[model samples]
Target: MEQLKKLDKIKVAIADDLDFFRKVLVDIFEEEEEFIVSGVYKNGQELIKNIFAIKPDIILTDFKMPDGDGLYVIEKINEMKYNIPVILISSYAKQDNEGILECLEKGAVDIIEKPTEQSFKASFDLLKTSLLKKIRYIYNNCVVLNQVKTVESKTTDYIAIGASTGGTKAIETIMRDVKRLSKTTIFISQHMPARYTTAFAQRLNSICSNGITEAINGEKIKSGHCYIAPGNFNLIFAGDHIELTDASKQIVSPGIDIMFQSFVSEAEKTCGILLTGMGSDGATGLKKLHDHGAITVVQDERSSVVYGMPKSAIEIFIVDYILPLNLIAGFINSISQ
Candidate 1:
């Protein structure tokens, strides 16, 4: 407790149309010395006007603001190139699973569902815990947004990708840079919630030339496409195609290790690429792939948002190359050629 007090309190900005809800956030922060309410605004317009002046470490905004919405705030923040993390709060019904994915794609680090009136006490307790935990996690592992290069390559047989935390953006960068190959099949296992994965897959499909789709159970994994493992299941390669199963009850959905372990038996002419993430989910699996004669690569710490996954793999001495985010696509293309 004494050590915690010595550390700087996290500065938070609140933007919502409801005066009552804004006060509720203030009151919650008042109870905890670890956080300080830096500014409170009634609408997105007000928050946008004084955002830089207030300079809060994090922002909590409602999905539907009178002047501008949460998406507007997020876009404007991105335009300004501020690394500040934003969290959106909405009633569960208002923002469906797709809407939640939209918020994440727009750059909100996380989302919180508002509790109902009847169960305010109990739900608010859970909400407070979830909000603070996400804020701290994102704050500690802030990502450095970087640009990547596009490259065309000869076709390879198979490629596997694992990422988490700030991985959505990283994956987007990688996918955008690579030219679609007719004979290469890409498998991605990104750490995400169940409902949001579908939207994420759709979003990627719209941007990349390669066909990107959410992995389904017993689907024939085809070449010239990218398959994202559904957030509720683990994507495993059974023979020539892919299968989704809930056999592993791991904490993180679409566990990288589970997917990587599945590649050991079918490690013929395979390449495993581990990107930025929070935990050591891909370490052991990547080691297995290496031991089974597969090319293994990890994103270096300098280019990663959170270096936990790659660092874990490096510590285990299984990585073939540690490359920066910008060079990863080129490296992949070179190896395939």
Candidate 2:
């Protein structure tokens, strides 16, 4: 008797109002061998009602639906403490930037545009690629990170921070809690758009005691000041000065690795902090800093929105301290003092 191969499939649930579009989504997932369509709902209300029974690994939901919307579903999932990653699919993504941002804030892991009848083929092709990438990304980064390395406390003159995804809220919390530094110069490299970085800096400055501003080219670094790396650009150290470089070609803009690597020569005086972010962007650079005797700290898994960056650094055995979100600011203050 010939034995058949059994596949472990990733269960996917969908919630969309339009019948034709819902059918199209089901058809798309049905063609993939690794994916199993677990349940389909016409609106957020139906999905929420049966979510516990379906137990989907991932969810794809339309942004606007009667009875309940994608944002409502995300809020409900958070309230229920369900860890399933949800992705928002919207037809008006091109024009609704604010709405998309709000969805991200509400707990959607990622977002993509829904295919319209006119551009079905082309739009669906890109959507399929992005959708598959996000799904794999969520599962691929499910690395367990509970280990903590003991490190002696050391005073630091320079501080570098890197973050992405849920970084804005994390950064705000840190900056607000941190008392003004007397001699430390902080550098922040957050993944953001060019137009928003200035506004972000302004927001941080209003809440924090330290002077926070977007870094400029060939500017001398000052103590008790925080420099935010401009979006779509890389911030690098140039002997106590800062320089900005165009980073359009790079996979992750405002490359945290570049900023972290620049401190290699002055490692003993620098403190590298990698916060919550996706992928392994800053892990290697933090490793280099650690090898050279620099203080390296990573946000612990439980406190992180996405533990990809910290997990990567931890896996490499280069992290010095793993603290929760609330303790990071105090840790930095203690190190500087």
- What is the TM-score (0 to 1) of candidate 2? 0.56
lDDT of 1: 0.78
- Candidate 1 residue-wise lDDT, 1-337, digit = tens: 0001212777889998887789888998889888999899998888888987877878999987678888888888866655467889987536477767877865676688877567788888898888878777765543222211112122347888999978999999888767767877889999998889999999999998789999988888787789999987999977677888893477997989989888887675678889999989999999898888777878878568999999999999746666656556655555452
Candidate 2 Cα errors over 4 Å, as ranges:
1-153
lDDT of 2 by residue, 1-337 (tens): 1111222787889999999889988888888889999999999999999988987878899998898899889889867645567889898888988988888866676788888888887777787778888786664432111111113345788999999979999999889867788898999999888899999999999999899999999999998899999999999988779999999788887899999999999899999999999999899999999889788888878669999999999999746666666556766766674
- Native-to-model Cα distance after best TM-score fit, residue 119 in candidate 1, in Å: 67
Please report the candidate that would top TM-score against the real structure. 2
Tell me the lDDT of model 2 at 149.
12
Question: How well does model 2 score by local distance difference test?
Answer: 0.82
